[model samples]
Target: MTDTAHALAASHTLWELVGRRAELTPDRPVLLQGDRRLTFGELRGRAERVAAGLYGMGVRPGTVVAWQLPTRIETALLSFALARLGAVQSPVIPFYRHREVGFALRASRAEFFAVPGVWRGFDHTEMARALGAKGVFEAYDDLPDGDPSVLPAPPADGTAVRWVYWTSGTTSDPKGVLHTDRSLIAGGSCLAHALRLSADDVGSMAFPYAHIAGPDYTVMLLLYGFPAVLFEHFALPAALDEYRRHGVTVAGGSTAFYSMFLAEQRRRPGAKVIPTLRLLAGGGAPKPPELYHRVVREMGVQLTHGYGMTEVPMITMGSPDDTAENLATTEGRPPEGMRIRIVDGEVRLRGEAVCQGYLDPAQTAQAFDEEGFLRTGDLGRLTDSGHLVLTGRLKDVIIRKGENISAREIEDLLHRHPAVGDAAVIGLPDAERGERVCAVVEQPPGAPALTLPAVTEYLRGEGLSVHKLPEQLEVVDALPRNETLRKVLKYRLRERFSA
Candidate 1:
């Protein structure tokens, strides 16, 4: 990290970081969207005004405020405004519907709720009203604004739990992950340092800003004094123009994002997809080595994947200076304060970046080990070089005939096949075998149709163990993915294919 960033990282609160960055680079742009730009000075100044506005509405320090809005300049302003007041924030993903939103509002006991009103056809305000949400307000195009003089002092304490983020909740109801300002700062610092970002680099947020990565990426920009383009609704082809317009140097959300860019590049082979694009970096889902090599060779860019969760925003991240072998096979290394432990092959983490705990006391108790390390439930081992090699999740291990089969191992091999665009290996219920291995694949455009026999034959040619071979094959147009990072919804696949 640069000296400026290191110094800025010492700030006790997000509002403090914003103020310091604005003081240092007031003229520099911090956010860009559709010809609109917000400089550091404007960010701090406007956020304070918004804080004053929110204060007028009776939102005081420690007041619980939940917001479900799209990724817009106004959303950041509102969030920072809340931060300025030291109010506890609960950000609900805009993609979430009644059940999730209601659950979050009720769980957090929010005193205020910010919604986009009517966004992308759905009426968020109406839904909030239906759910009997408190302090419902529309903050889509116009946010609350008041004189900065009316605002109270910004937050000083960073260790207090001030943020509640929801897990994807693939299998069950989403868990409310609690985070503090310092934990979020540590997470973003790790990301900014690992990527070796500079002020000259322009980043892009193609995912929902409501996700935990919202703060993670925002802190990186605040530290580095760079700007990132915001995409309210990210889709290929349509969003490509904005990326080109902003000259995004770093673009990625997850492995799925890498694949999306690769697919776009294939549409116009030999031509740079985004001319200014230099690196694709993200971490939410597993990254296949074949995807890494293909990205480097085909897209002509460095692809750095990482290990992160809602609990720990950034556990490990691949460095651009690392070797190709390590970059391709490992999830890089944790920063100085992060400690990684492996017990019975499960990756455990203990670091400042790690969240304090979940909202449920019981869940929090079960999530940590006796040593205070957060039990990740992810199976992985650290290489001799300290790079993390994640094999699979504990629930992802397939038990067929009393033998364990790694779904990630099979999925990684499947990516090498020419016709396979992406694959998800899942265990389906089988009366005889206990659980049958199922390979769900989505073939790339113009690739030959895949069959059960063809896929199994290819895996056999690749030397997959017989027991690990997928007993069932399901070819789909696309795998189910979450809106935030496009992580494949394996639980959905298990639900879909089990029948």
Candidate 2:
């Protein structure tokens, strides 16, 4: 972190940081969408107006306000407005439907609900009404505006829990992850410092703003005084023009985003997909080492993957200065304040960036150890040089005949095959082996079909242990993925192929 950013990081709250950044670079652009651009000065001034507007609607400090809005500039404004008021805000992913939305609203006990009314052919306002949401209001393109003079003093305590983020909930109901302004600022500071980004670099947010990454990525921009283009609805080829128009220098949301860009580059081999794109960086799901090499070799950009989740939005991140071996095989290193402890192969963390806890006290008790480190449930080891090497999830480990096997190990090897585009390895119910290894794969376009024998042979050739070899193979046209960061839904695969 630079001396300026280090000074800015000392700000007590998000609103304080916003005020500081605006003072430093008031005229600099902070957000860009389509033809609209918001400067640091505008962000601060407009957010205060919006805060006063919410105050008029009975929203005060600590009020639980839930919003299910898209990735629009307005969404960021409203969120910052709430921050200025010190109101507890719960942001719902725009793609979530009735079940997920209702769960978040009820779990947070939201007093006011914000929606985009009707977005992309869905009636969110109507659904909010059906769910009996309190204080339902629309906050899409038009926001409530009032005199900044009427607003209360900005929040001073950054440690107060003011944000509630939701888990992806691929297999079950989403859990509301509690976070404070300082925690979010810490998370974003770590990321910005790790990536070594500067004000000259332009970033892009292709994921949903409701995702924890919204604050994670936003803080990076605020700290560096750079602008990121917001994609309300992001899709490849369709969203390519905006990236080009804004000259996006850093672009990526996760491993899936890297694949999307790589596929686009393959369509036109020699030409750069986005001429201004210089780096691909993100982390939410597992990143195969082979994917990193292919991205560097084919797309001609530095690919830096990280490790994070809703509980800790920025854990470890690969740096451009790191060695290729470390970049390809490890998930970078944690920042100075972040501590990584491995207990029984589980990666536990303790840091200011880590979320306070879940909404439920029981869940919070179960998530942490007596030492106060948050149990990540991920299996990983710290390298001699401090880089994190995640092997697999504790739940993802397949036990066969009383022997433990890492599905990630098999999946990583499978990705090396020319025919395999993506793969998800799961354990299936088998009376013989207790649990059988199942390889579910999606073949790249124009690749040959793969069978069980062929997959097993490939694994054998890669020197995989006999016990870890997949017993069955299932090929599909496309892998099921969550809409936000495009993480593969492995639980869905288990349910689909178990029978």
Candidate 3:
């Protein structure tokens, strides 16, 4: 074997993998968490029913069936069901305050929205009533209420819209990321290969199934012929309990989730949790490097991170044969057939697995290069070893009088401070330099107070440019995050600075 390559395990189509593997291991447990269990055969049965139901309800190829539901078996099955019938599925967080929900619904022109009659003790119906009053009404329901005998047939041609993933708006308001069943199924297979999924591993899912990672994990596991443990909530205790009790072997979620998981584990020492958990993974944020080492020692799991956005998500990830740096630092090589490049520090991808374009044609035109690479907005480079490395981000860099400073670097340095619990660095308005760096922080318990002068003094010790250092550092209790819990909200930080 070459010194590189991580060695190819070869790639397969998303549905091809799932359908083939379902046939291979039909009786194996495909989905389970707590008391719930569905063998591959059983799960496929439910998926068939969901496909039939969606088909029966006028969901068709190119139709966007918006899902506003929970992370339960029904939701996951419904997703696959729509995929089975060539229906493009668009799911937004069900609890998004009325404005955000209305915006996404209208933006996607969503025809069918499967919302709970009640969710998290609030009335989604009430929210629906409000939006309905605005001359905008979508087909809304509480949840699925059908049985397995009502299975539907798969679509004939493969051109149907598979999924329309919404961008997290780290830099701008959310936009629709469009992918086909062909592309999404490809994504599933690509992620499975990156993670080295095996039938022996019981996958643990915590991210919302609506997002790329969660649904991708669910489908990848089923398609890979492996058991998948589903969690409806991101509760750390429940997650650990699932690990210890149910023998979950792999996990993927956001950095916030892993941070909270570690915190909860520390709260209960000597708990033999996730004993079989060989891999602990994160995406969405570049947390401190210490997080990897901590997970290795405390949780008995190998910590890995990846590079993806809601747009061209899951193209790069750490592989099974990766070294420590390869695992924790760079996002692994572009998945199977994926193509990527870094021009002017902006990362862009072009491949079949990549999304076709955003729902808006103008936005799509703005996001891609002339030759058609999906501009990923992240700042990264490919390593000599063929791995993809994200340094900072193009949109997140702060420029002051032609001196470009990385907000990630400042955030990383701030996190190194013992008293700092969490920090978010952003660029706000500036009269001369075009933009100025601002540091918003949440302090650790009993942590010493951090002021602007102290932050400047610390950066000065590092010999950073005075202007490059944050002009302002405000201590706060929380920072806003989208469904993925990313902290690159330059918009809010800008308003805060202006006010």
Candidate 4:
């Protein structure tokens, strides 16, 4: 890892961050999959060649390049390669059907797509052909037919767009969220500070690399001189093993991930994990206090809660020393290079961590104030200690005649019921009481049948305000989840109940 002036100039890019990583631990492993592993030096060389190969195909910087490959070393390296060439990486989940993939391709406006003819057992060739995309870089990871070259030259400075992230389209077509080198680098720097990460840490994410959390978190890990392990998915059983195998000290993910693993822990009692494990952090949806309790008390790790979006990946959260209560109650204060304002009880943020906004200027303008604070659609209040406590989504609260109720408070209370495994509170259009409170629930495995009366009784015993209590309760098999497994399309419940 040479200290070229070019590296310093482009220090915010993914490849540049890894260059710093190489200097810190040249002989240490940077990536691991099953039995295979790559040291920093080896990874640097291979990724360089991959970048050069894409360059040879005229894949220039700022190019929106998509991935039709699986979660292999190639997919990871190609993502790095594109960033090195000043190109944007757009990763599509293999689970996405043809129609969904088409939407992503169109929304991202990807000019180049790297696809493996086949991945695992899936035949990607037909899908690639169906894509009808030109400049397709096709290669099979199981075997290499030819050699790739060294890294391509960096893109010119002050490039307008560094990355393109599609908004999770819970309701409609996903809009692309553009990022700059400034935004990406700022994200890395803030994450490093927020988690108090170190070179001794090994960061492994089980989510998709195309995500804001995935790639941005990887950049932070690599910049802090830590190796990052990627799983095809969140393999909880293998995760602890990999943590120990990679000497991993930090773990992070969503609330659902923790809940799933907790269920597994319940299934298999007496399961212990990596001795060096220090931190377990994540936040996508509202996390229950009990979840954090298990992560700290049972899993034997520090639990953290982060608040971010596809635009600004890591914005605010409880740090390592933050109490479990604060982490569960609040989204934490705004991080460095960011600002937070509460107007009419709505959260508004501004600064480098904020997204430049959506691709549409009209939407962007609508998302921000004339003064430039990104008007976040979340409702929250600042505690006397300056911690931010999220009440619920601005649109999720129900106004019953004169009183306002937070759905999150009701949902959290419903979760306390031993019979209710999962819950969502929605405001249904009601001719009476203005908008009535409705609760949708999922029963836990091996739990007794849950009736509406039983749920109402539990809510009442929990001492919820009468107005906050859900007037109607509907039991469902499972809630819908988006790519990251966060329940994004909650409106479905209201639609069903109305029908």
TM-score (C-alpha, index-matched) for candidate 2: 0.99
Candidate 2 segments whose C-alpha is farther than 4 A from its true place: none
- Runs of candidate 3 with Cα error greater than 4 angstroms are 1-18, 133-153, 169-173, 268-273, 432-434, 460-467, 486-488
> Taking the tens digit of each residue's C-alpha lDDT, what string does model 4 give over 1-499?
1233224324755566667667767888777777888777766667677777777777776677877555566677777666667787676665565666678777677787666776666767677677776556675473222134444466545335767677766557776777876677666556666677666778777776657776667666566556777776566675667667777676667778777656655665666555676777777778766567766777667777877777777778777767667876777766656887899999888877677788778888788887888887888888987788888888988899878999988888877777777888888888878888888888898889877777777878889877677788888888766656454368778788864
Model 3 residue pairs with clashes? 14-185, 18-223
TM-score per prediction, in order, is 0.99, 0.99, 0.88, 0.90
Better of 1 and 4 by TM-score: 1
Report lDDT (Cα) of residue 75, candidate 2: 98
Ranking by lDDT: 2, 1, 4, 3
* Lowest summed lDDT window (length 10), candidate 4: 1-10
Candidate that beats the other on TM-score, 2 or 3, i.e. the better one:
2
For 393-458, candidate 2 gives per-residue lDDT tens digits of: 999999999999999999999999999999999999898899999999999988988989988988
Model 2 weakest 10-residue run by lDDT: 167-176
Candidate closer to the true structure by TM-score (higher is better), 3 or 4: 4
Query: What is the full ranking by TM-score, best candidate first?
Result: 2, 1, 4, 3
Residues 1-499, model 3: lDDT tens digits:
1111121112233344446556767889877867878777766676666666666666666677777666777776777677666676788765465766777777878777766567678777678667762322222332343553554445554445567777654444678888765666556556776776666777777777777776566656655667777776666565676766778777767677666766665676786355677887657777566566666678767777776667755777777778977776676776768888889888888876677888899988898899888887788788999998776878688887787888877876777676777788888778877877888988867878988999888878867766678887888887766554543455676777765
- How many residue-pair clashes does candidate 4 contain? 3
